[model samples]
Target: MITGKNYIGSQLKAAGTKIYKTINPQLNIENPWSFIEATPEEINEAVALANDAFKIYKNYPAQKKADFLNAIAEEILALGDELLEVYCSESGYPKGRAEGERGRTIFQLRTFANMLTEGSWLEATIDTSIPDRLPLPKDDLRKMLVPLGPVVVFGSSNFPFAFSTAGGDTASALAAGCPVIVKSHSMHIGTGEMVASAVIKAAKKNNIPEGVFSNLIGSGVTLGTSLVKHPLVKAVGFTGSINGGRALFDLASQRPEPIPVFAEMGSINPVVILPDALEKNSKKWAAAYAGSITLGTGQFCTNPGLLLGIKGEKLNQFIDQLAEEIEKIAPSCMLHPSIKADFNNGKEKIQSQNGVSTVAEYKGEIAPNYAPQTILTVDGKTFLENPALSHEVFGPFSIIVQCKNNEELLTIINKLDGQLTGTIIAEPMELSNYNAVVDALQNRVGRLIFNGVPTGVEVCASMIHGGPYPASSDSRFTAVGIHAVKRWVRPFSYQNWPDELLPSALQNKNPLNITRTVNDIITNKPI
Candidate 1:
């Protein structure tokens, strides 16, 4: 059970509220957890502390900030069994998922730490003064990335560890030298508290300010709204449903100061199966897709909710095989009871839509809170006509769309909303004729997968985990990989300042000895 002792940095205070622990619906057991709702006063205090921390935190040396991030990762690892247990109890996710997400969280923190020590990510540039130009000599200009102020991060329920407190948003913000306040997901408050403790420990070890990172627990939207609308909050990061993310974006934009909100909303993550490819590997592809759709009970945002294909005998064969394979898989519990309820509702709604047919559903009774893996299909014309088919169901369910022709396939892809990923399953020769379809997919999604499942996200430097509106608040930026830090930073230019007065990344000598672009060439030596 969490006690007052667990509230790191800040003393536990009474805010005139009753507390309740979240129950595990699958196990029929009460988890040892309760969260203190942050009053309006507490919210202001947290944000104020973060704002103050930003003053020094934003200007702190990159190496020092790196140390803090690395320490947090280490402390989280040190939590070991305790962290994973809390994750599973609160989220109802299995042990493997809890551990995997914990690892991803740690990897994210350490990756940013590496970025800090290695330097050179700042994208420095030096334009030597045009001393002999026909026009008046221009001042020598230098540019590099600089930290924004305090940031507010809203964690997603699906990934409480990797996208919650001390997750990608907080890690990247800290890496960029910005203070962070995480609006902890109510679904996994225990996980959030454990991670918050890790951050506090790291802050102490690194001698960073106490308020550099704060975690606020709340079940409703009020706390999140206050944080994003708060004047001191300079930026926001979020991952959740389209409705929730859009509301936050609108709130931020409506603010008097109008801060940037990088919200990774919902995605159907469409997968296009070409006729030839289906014909070539119908059984194998069907099996692989069954695994992907059922993996993690389809909790992943990249779950291929929409499958598109040109209508033919091959397509029919593939759908039948897929239905058979999907039925063979067992139903699993969703992350939370609320999620399961919503999943069932969404599936029913989709099934009720005109021209929709249920291909597969759990025949046996599912235990409480379990999600029955379901497969539904609709024609290309009906899918295109009904916008409801395009929405995300957020569970282990998939809708197969049979397009009448290549043109219909193209039209469906074009008409679809933005997505985190768009996949193309094609035979080698068939791909040569589908350049337009591929190009259209690329334009609509942040990442394009070729003949591969989109469920597994590779944590690497080049990965882009964000996409166009509804998929994410900003298509220009990414939510994962080394580039996630870009969300917490903005470009700042200095014009001919004295070498000693400039930031280290922009100084004349570049004492950090990082590479800079000069005369269209990357060089460590400054011009």
Candidate 2:
């Protein structure tokens, strides 16, 4: 099943001479599957085909799009155990994680499918003409969101299924009626290829346009750079490192016709443990935090990398207990050796910095590519002064910042950059006392958790997975949920157009029966 070729639309092309193989991080060896990177010419062809496919796909019926999405979900499930095994082989993640992520990917497709069928995603609005007005005449005006042509999606390395080939970004763009070209991640290219096969099969089965989706396999920057810089590519979606996502944002922005790049880069999600809460249940909170920090090997973007608390007797007890709890958990392997190396280097750099002290270190021998669950502590003053300490370590590691008092803790939260999530661990009515601190956190993060860890982002309509710069390129849109489709669509208005020319959702007959605003009233009624 490993073809070692790029899936350009409906056909496989192996025109590039450069070849790479997916590595088995658990074994510290390379897998047998070899993949040829897409050439510059092939990138152009894929982008061009996507642009052409948009002409037909952008106007396709919603039911057809929904069918295509459902088919993709079905086909991925049909791949079954083979896909899960390859996912585990490519990345060092366990079988349970592989299965769970695959389930998330399938659920995302089905969620978008249901959203499309419900048709409210169109956001149709209308204002009937007032021809006989005494002062002036008001012409009939209708507005609705429309697809923005072709989109380029960069699959993530950490999530082989949920945020990779058939991830949220790709699913949302396709649901918005835009064609997609995926820039497959290098770490899990084999898993990506397997998922890409299912996508192509579904597209063919539903008779969807050929170029509606394409998967290009490239281990370097050339293919991705070319895809983003291509004139025909309208919007971009990415889930990866800050440097990589920022690079794509820069490239797309420099083009003559700049496009929107929704990059969910990275974040050091912070959790504030108020003094009262610490005093109430210091040990309980400590154990919970240890699990949160090391969950999924700390590979999650929302992993609680930074924890804040007011310095006091209770806070010290919490810190020491948290370190002890973390030391008990066994080490887990990262997705790649490079990732583990980076994690160790980050830990060392923080430890070497002036005024930073090691809180806990797991000295246990780790398996190949395994990361040690470690914790370090630094004064709030030091953490605030050293910007390097604020960056995400991207592994099973977290830094605890002990503030001098509540005022300093509030100041630190206000100084932080955008984050995917920020949590507040408070006692009863404690939140009301720290209004300024809560307000500061809300400003810096997309989502606020009252008393919970930031991991395990739910795939639902209410979740917001993007934040300000560095957390994501554009905080206005989310990379998760039904609203994510907004990133690939723009509001379009029509004036005095005939009913026959209007889209089905906006037609006078209420053909779709979706709720819409007409004459300033929301209804599912015909005009």
Please report the candidate that would top TM-score against the real structure.
2
Candidate 2 residue spans exceeding 4 A from truth? none
- lDDT, candidate 1, 1-527, per-residue tens: 35412232344443737464666756856776666777778888888888888888888888899989989999999998988888888777788988888999999998999998778789888787777887688788888898889998888888988888888888999999888888878777778887888888889899998678887776547788888889999999998989998888899999989999999989989999998888779999999999999988899999989999888899889988998998998888787788888998999999999999998887888888888899999999999899998889999999999899989899999998999999999988989999999999998999999989999887778999999888999999998988999998988888878878988877777788888886567898854
Evaluate residue 527 in candidate 1 and report its C-alpha lDDT on the 0 to 100 scale: 46
- Pairs with backbone N, CA or C atoms under 3 Å apart (clashes), candidate 1: none
Provide the lDDT at 370 for model 2.
89
Q: Please, what are the lDDT tens digits per residue for candidate 2 over residues 332-382? A: 889988898899898888888998888888898888798888898889999
Clashes of each: 0, 0
CA lDDT, candidate 2, residue 493 = 93
Q: List the residue pairs that clash in candidate 2.
A: none
